[model samples]
Target: MTTPRPAAPSPTDALPGGLGRRFSWRGRQIAWTAFGDGPPLVFCHGTPWSSWLWAPYARALSAQFTVHLWDMPGYGASSMLPEHDVDLGVQGEAFAALLAHWGDGWGEAPHVVAHDYGGAVSLRAALLHDARYASLCLVDVVALRPWGSPFFRLVRDHAPVFGRLPPAVHRGALEAYVGTASHRGLRDDELEALVVPWLGDAGQAAFYRQIAQADERYTAELEPLLGDLDVPTRVLWGEQDTWIPADRAGRLSAALGHAEARLIPDAGHLIQLDAPVALATELRGWLAEVGAGRR
Candidate 1:
């Protein structure tokens, strides 16, 4: 029941829109993509997913904004250093480097759309690195204390064991775990996109390594600073989210003082996949409200 090593990804399979590019950061190759023209909007994907998660949405928003997407170090086409820990803190640094890479091309402060663990990474980059963003939209984020699902706890506790599971076992576990993120169940293509990266030897090891490195300490460090956000922020949640619970959105909104929390009914943690049209509409409206579109 050993999992065979996956062949190298074809150029077209490397990234959505055939736009995948690579850069060296912290001795690792970071993969990213940018498209469209106009003000920049960066999309940060959650755990077990990559920039591919935002492909459709990025295309939707490209008409009005230059959409950027990236796979955090351990996910997608990015380098997965088994010896190094790619925790929230490290992700924040990588994000900062990305901002620098975008430089003046990103205009005055890019807008951010982050989901799941991406919310944690974005928050750390904002608070710790002083990364400037015109506005931010957090969806089904892991930004508060008492976070992590029962399964997340299990993985954190036995990451090494899970990492060493037979390939088929790992694949089954991955598919099942990701399925819970959406209430409507994942489509075959969607599931394959999310699961393919975790199928190979390096990908399999990186999957568990990421879980093992999950630490609330980084989020804890930003909790106190949440209330001090100086940019426009909106908290969006999937009403039926079973992973992080929708109520956390209220807490996040309260922390942001002026930000409002909105819920998309009939959607789950993976709102991008469940209700992409609604998510894109909400984001467009928010950007307009914050005058991000004008920039």
Candidate 2:
């Protein structure tokens, strides 16, 4: 069962301006891109999502800071072979490696903006891998315990069975699963951008492979170490997040050493799309602190 290496996609193949480059991490070519010249800022996305999640924000903030984004090895526009390890612990190490790979790009500890499971990865990178950040903003992140929707639990227990589903059936399930993330339904094109990575033979298998590999122990291990981090932090959640209830926001902020937790109204788990304007305002305000500190 050899998985042939697929051709790499054009850097700007999907998201406008895209994460237009690659970084080799543990033998996997991770897709990434960066822009601007102000203080550096990096974005880390969560499960079932990719660098596209930050494309628009990257473009808007590029005018103020060098914004960097990348797709995890088993995620969008990156390697998705069945054998690739795409779990949280590995992802954290990869993120740490990705940052180090950039060398002087992080001469100054960069600001980090993370969403969902990306939060866990960034935290691990900092706690275990010695990755430093000027500041951290966690948006509807996956950090607390007892996560995983019923579907996630089902798939986690039987990923191989689900991975073997007919392509059409898998597509429908993916669409429906993703739909739950937004309070307002996503546009067809929007949904396509998020779902496209999990289509076809390789993508479908990779999709379930990631779900199967998802384990909360990665975050649990870092929980007690939360307050040990001295980095400035902000926590945000969509008021209507059905996937990870909004109630977890305050606890997470508290665990992060009295950090602020603000909930955005009318948005669900996918705050970037559900409430872009508000999310942007919050992010800009949060990042502004970093700018002020250096001045």
Candidate 3:
């Protein structure tokens, strides 16, 4: 039986490094935690992972920048989107709305840090609404191609069938996919932490529904738009990313025209988890290099 999910953390937490949580957007409860007291840097996590994935980096970067993190819809503490056909379009619109809200009242555009699916979401925001971003740090992002795990292909083809299977099949497939993509593998607590949020029927349905919305054409759109993007963009990659081949790093840089790529020697698909300090240092340096310091 599923126990009550833990109460989401409050906007103001007792943790060190400038922490706050429970930020709302349009009455939709979005679990947001921020740290530091400088120019804002918003972080967006990839699929199956929530904002909690970036907690370490948020803690480290809080010293130099006010780090903002949010659980995307259907993940972490945020409410799932009501629509069943949630795609990049819907997600992009929501993200655009967030940036517009931030620009109007919260503060000026913040430097965006994104990973994997977050990268795509961030790019969508930047391409359509460039005014809300100061700079970008995209890591393990999908771009310029249709590179994805074989498992993703399976999901794309079989979600309708597998999505209807008994709870055990659903649970097993989710666990296996998570295991295959995770480079260093997750500990028991870590696995439970990530898996617990998606255990119920609502959560499972949302997961499949969202997955169905990802269109490979989104990557193609980035290729043409990257050249026109004025915001100084940078790429970070795990040297040994299994899910997204390491070779794609070069492709992304070349396609972006003005972006630089950094390969973290021993990191994997989850760069923030594998090398928090190194990632933070690189980001801080980039922030400084690009004048992304507190405004």
Candidate 4:
């Protein structure tokens, strides 16, 4: 029997990363959370993941910066209806629109931290849509050309077929695929938290929808102009990131005008789970630079 889905989280409920509020953009509700009292720092997550990926770091950094996190329109606690355009193109616009929604903080430029495909979306917002930022941190991000794993390609080509799989089959594929992102392997709880969002029909269909819409052209449009980005940038990678391969970090750094490609040891693509402390130390340091009015 298909399990009846749980009630959608209300604003009063304790949620993952404590993201209990919503921001409506383009008729879609975007779930978000914020804390601390310093300059604004926004985090953007990539595919099959949500703001929960950054929850630990958000709290760790909360002491010094007002850390903000939100699920994209079709991810996390946000809307995932069939009518919503959750592709990178629309994601970019939604991101820029969210920034506008937070325009009261404009006196201080927000620092944007993006992971995976989020790198492309944030770049599109900053470069094309004219969203400003104090700095940017691209961590295990999908920005350069030739991205998308073979599995990603498979799903992109056959999303409808895969989406129709029996629940057991889809869950199996989801576990196997998402597990590969972290070299150290996830604890039972971590794995469950990540997997639970894509369990039911809405989540399952949205999962395939995003994969089918994953296109290299999104980053392609921003590559030539990477050097023109005026904000300070930091490119970070996991030493053992087999998914994107650590080598791509160097190329991305060079493309961003020689920003150093900092690698965290004993981690993979999902550094947030594999090496939280190391990543946090790096962020605290870099964000310290960003916070000190060092442009």
lDDT leader: 2
Clashes of 4: 0
Query: Worst 10-residue stretch by lDDT in candidate 2?
Result: 5-14
Please write out the lDDT profile of model 3 over residues 9-56, one tens digit for every residue: 432232353233554655555566666878888888878777767777
Between 2 and 4, whose TM-score is larger? 2
Query: Across residues 1-295, which tens digit of lDDT does each residue of candidate 1 receive?
Result: 9866445343225344654688788788888888777788999988978877787788777877888888889888789888777999999988988887886665478999999989999988988998999899999998998787789889999998998899999999998998998988987777777788888799899998998899999898989999888888999999999999999999999987888999998899989889888887898899888876633
lDDT of 1 at 57: 81
Which stretches in model 3 have alpha-carbon errors above 4 Å? 1-29, 81-84
Task: Go through the candidates in order and give each one's C-alpha lDDT.
Answer: 0.85, 0.87, 0.72, 0.85
Question: What clash pairs does model 3 have?
Answer: 11-20, 11-21, 18-35, 39-294
Stretches of candidate 4 off by over 4 Å are 1-17, 292-295
Candidate 1 C-alpha error for residue 276, in Å? 1.7
- Candidates in order, TM-scores: namely 0.93, 0.93, 0.86, 0.92
Candidate 2 clashing pairs, residues 3+ apart or interchain: 19-32, 116-142
> TM-score of predicted model 1?
0.93
Worst 10 residues of 4 by lDDT: 8-17
**Candidate 2 ranges with C-alpha deviation above 4 Å:** 1-17, 292-295
| RMSD to the hidden true structure, all candidates | 3.2, 5.1, 4.0, 3.6
Clashes found in each candidate (C-alpha, N, C closer than 3 A):
0, 2, 4, 0
Instruction: Kindly report which residue stretches of model 1 are placed more than 4 angstroms away from their true locations once superposed.
Output: 1-19
